[model samples]
Target: MFLEKLASKGVTLAQLPIPVVRNEVERLVLSYAQQRQWFLWQMEPDGSAYNIPTALRFRGQLDLAALQRSFETLIQRHEALRTTIGEEDGQLLQVIHPCQPFELARQAVGTLDEGALQAQVALEVQQPFDLARGPLLRVKLLDLAQEEHVLVLTLHHIVADGWSMPLLIDELVSLYEGYSQGREVALAELPIQYADYAIWQRAWMDAGERERQLAYWMSQLGDDHPVLELPTDRPRPAQQSYRGQRINVDLGEALGLSLKQLVQRQGATAFMLLLASFQVLLHRYSGQADVRVGVPIANRNRVETERLIGFFVNTQVMRAAFDTQLTFSELLAQVRQRALAAQVHQDLPFEQLVDALQPERSLSHSPLFQVMYNHQTRVKGERRSLPGLEVESLPWRVHAAQFDLTLDTFEHEHGFSATLTFATDLFDAATIQQMATHWRNLLQGIVANPDQRVAELPLMDDTDRQHIVDGWNATQADYPGDTSIHQLIEAQVFATPDAPALVFGEHTLTYAQLNRRANQLAHKLREQGVGPDVLVGIAMERSLEMVIGLLGIVKAGGTYVPLDPEYPQDRLSYMFEDSGIPLLLTQSHLRETLPIPAGLRSLDLDGENLEGYSDANPNIDVAPLNLAYVIYTSGSTGRPKGAGNSHQALVNRLWWMQKAYGLDASDSVLQKTPFSFDVSVWEFFWPLMTGARLV
Candidate 1:
């Protein structure tokens, strides 16, 4: 509607006032962006990770001389094209070279097919440029056929960026359109060059602007620098592997329109809505509450720098906290607020942000954020036309990745075209392909129901859901049914009476000896009112007696909770109060440190008098559905949450372990984990029930 109103009033974006920096003098000091590139270039002297190459194809008769003249004039117009980095007095600076005769490398490969042509293009893209020896830009012309030609423009990142690509292309086309017609028409000369703006930027930042923007950034970032832990196919290497490739993704026109409408209804831009959905995807992938994504903002807000060809782009970190309970609309609101705030503070150079925050540096990953999201509207390409020629943009393979993962989306006539560029070392092609599907699926889900919880949003289709819930879990093997955990051990005891069941220090209890001791304690426990479904607590360190106490309680049909003696008193007291245990079995030595509640019946396993109890097996009616044990997990929140498992579940897991690993008499299973964990449950019982030695 606002655009319609502008159209009604005969107002267009091109009519707006656009100021350009017009200075008579230039400065040698490099811009902050150039300085960052220089440092990286020094680190990897032969690395082409920072190279930028774009290609265009012409399918008509091309005047080579006119095109060459066009490039010569365009390169002379922008000093950045001829600029290279050098050092003066131990400080890096930009040195501008004089305008020299242009030489467009011509490669006549008319017989080469499409794939072979791209291979040659990839080689050209990978060629390294010498920053100190000048000529940081390369122009290559490939004569593919009689009436077809391909032009490749490659530049070092220190001189140009994404924004410069279109500007450079438009100027080059316009120059050719005029020169080919024997006309002298040309583009308006820029009032100032990139070097003049670099000087002006230093002066502008010195007038308290840099510190003013820094305040907002410092507050926004604080001490939080979260490393994205997106589960990858492989572990990350110690240093960054710049090797990368791109895969195309297309979200249908309908989904794109629906997403755009949803964004408009929420009073947010497309970037904000898409970024919010991306955060949801990352949170789902990593199960992290906080996500930080780096976005490259064309920091050309100042009209003076918009038309100049230099590395005017700066990265801004978009940091936000996500919650599973947040609705899609609610999450978008937060993203919208953060996006607007970041825009206000976008002038703060990312290089300076890294310098000021001084995060723990690692070569394996990027600082602050390792994933990037970029959105572009390719209206410039559609608007650009060359005289008497059909132009189609050709793609050159990406040989390096600037981040662990980067999503670059372009809005074109066909709705949305996206490509996910990822580090080849960390992820496989299929992982990224599935991620693209998930992201698209998430966006469709979000638009379908904007009020739904972000966590409840669909990231998988029915096929994926079925695969995860049923296909991968096709572990259908037969095992003994209706058997209690103790019954399995009883069968093992009968099969191997002399096998070692429990070992601590030098003392070893064979199956028969261990079962006899446990039976006597079970009988005593039953006499002390320990029966079915009764709660018992065993607080002791790792020892043979600790195992005996738990096994004895289970034999007596009571659920035992293992409490580590090394825990703090406050934690112990909280656990005791939470579980409401009636009986506690501990040792005499640990009684001083135990946080025993009032009216709790206590017995010391070593000090108790169980001599009169029968050594035979106690005929207790323990069912498979009875409560087995309770394990408390200290989760992200400080509170401990107790979860109880049934005997059937435990028995099934142990049976599956026995079937899978086939532990027999020769195997010695080491039980080192404390009894409070589920791993300890299997470590103690799986071996004892399978006639394997428990060490």
Candidate 2:
């Protein structure tokens, strides 16, 4: 219908050679945009983070008119500069506009200062472009002074990528010089345009080629793609804000040299080492072994496509597995292998790969990875000089982020300059600043000792280490040296004799009453040859008598070995044999269920024989370092093992708990945990030492 309207105006649309065949890459991009409802943004637009802003500061005699003419010529040379991306017949189409008068917007900001000029440039970058319209690019020239100027260039990502930035600049320099000299620019003729290459790519990717590349991606990513839940300063909103800022980081010359040397020694490229360091840093922050980072690759592999300006960049997912046992050198080698393999299979568009893998897609976050890494070291030379003008690239913040974090590193004369750009909504400036510092520290530590395990790399400097180790662990206080667990309880007994110390369903015992019961049981056990290094097994239902049995074992200077009666008889028999318990204390009904060791006595606490026992504290001399208990572990992974803990260890922990939580006589602790687990030891001892009631 639009062609018929053009024909009525004496414009033959069919005379033009613009092809309408959909390209594979463009088709996939259109499908993704449609699914996300991004086209609706054309009606109600949001200033997306997809805009690429580049500004060059020039300090010399500048030719504004000649520069503007040069930009117009470059637009005529590249059809992509005059192209619009829109949908026709429910498909993505690149409509090419005929070459016409093009004007670069120029503004004389001679009255404004440097800071004000930068603010104006930022405002220009924040403006959103209508992709469905004719022009998807813009340029502005700000005259800061008579001899100084700032040239700003902005483009939508649908038409251009990072590689195109340098190419565009280099061509602009040549064209500007030619127009200034009033001479014809002698440049080579183009082999094809971006649209032609896109069509060629779709034809090249046959069924066999698609399957071969997809299999590698599927095997590499596997079933699980770990999404990082980075700690954010503010809660994430239901939708992304795309707000972002950048923090500058530099690796000094000495460490940078060491890094290069280390990379050479490991037979890997600088990119692999940097990526390994990044993965290690993420591992330290997230404690996740699986690390995936998005890397944009220059997909212009052919010689013909190298010089053309187009969106030829493809994203490759670089997944690095960080094993604690692997050394930094080993990890670097693994990263190198994965990187090289990805470069080989770089032709697969990231959108297609995502479709093939079918990862759990979400609108709140990116799929597969939440962080991106890119290196622009190869193109630093292109930024040095623009014909006659001394060109210096201006580093400015993009008010948006495509991912949670993006680390862009560029090589320089001194060492390397790294900029960490992160979403402002997810992270504060301070957090990213610390992360930037940590990344540098990690690089320094790994270079200093590449042979060390990756997990052993020091992520913090001396100041941070001091703050964490010394500042947080200032928990020192005076504790008694000659006292044992029983001695502490005895002191509490003297202080609060009438306080309720133990309670179970309707049965309760005061401190004095509980001590007398334990004393009576201690005397009876002492008569049975139970002393220091002796083990007494206590197996009973949870009751007030259970607390008495545990205290009696410690009072008699014997190690208590608790066996849960509900456990299988096989496990109970193993614990008795492992600890070599000399005496078993239980109710009369449980005596038949347990396997009694030879020459070991099984005493029933409910027996009438205990009526003759003395209810006095025993005069036992037990040291603080003596064994307090021998707990047997469940044989889930291997053979069941018995661990012996000392009275000093238990007393120190209970003292720390008292000071940390301020536990006192007013507190009541729940003792529902089974005695077989180590957690139960702290729960059993914490209350008695703090003069708190246990139930």
Top of the candidates by lDDT: 1
Q: Tens digit of lDDT per residue, candidate 2, span 1-695?
A: 33343355464433422233333233422323222324435533666687877898887777777788888878887877887766757877677678878787888877666677778889888888887784777998887778777888998777777888788888888887777677778677777677765554554454255677888998999999888877788876666667888787877788778877887888887788888888888888888888899999888777777788777888889988877698988888888889999888987777778878888876567888999998767544235554566777776656778789998887655567778889887899999998988898999889888888988888889999998899989867787756789989988898999998988889889999999989999998999999987899999888777888999999999999999899888887788887888788998887777776778787888663665788878968998788999888778889889889898888888888787898788899999789888899888878987789998
Model 1 TM-score is 0.75
Model 1, 404-488: lDDT tens per residue? 9998888766567788999998999999999999999999899899999988999998889899889989877777657779888
* Model 1: how far residue 239 lies from native, Å: 4.4
| Prediction 1 global C-alpha lDDT | 0.85
C-alpha lDDT of all candidate models, in order: 0.85, 0.79
Q: Residue 157 error for model 1, in Å?
A: 1.3
Clashes of 1: 0
Error of 2 at 324 (Å): 9.9
Task: Assess the local accuracy of residue 653 in candidate 2 as a C-alpha lDDT between 0 and 100.
Answer: 80
Residue-pair clashes per prediction, in order, are 0, 0
Best by TM-score: 1
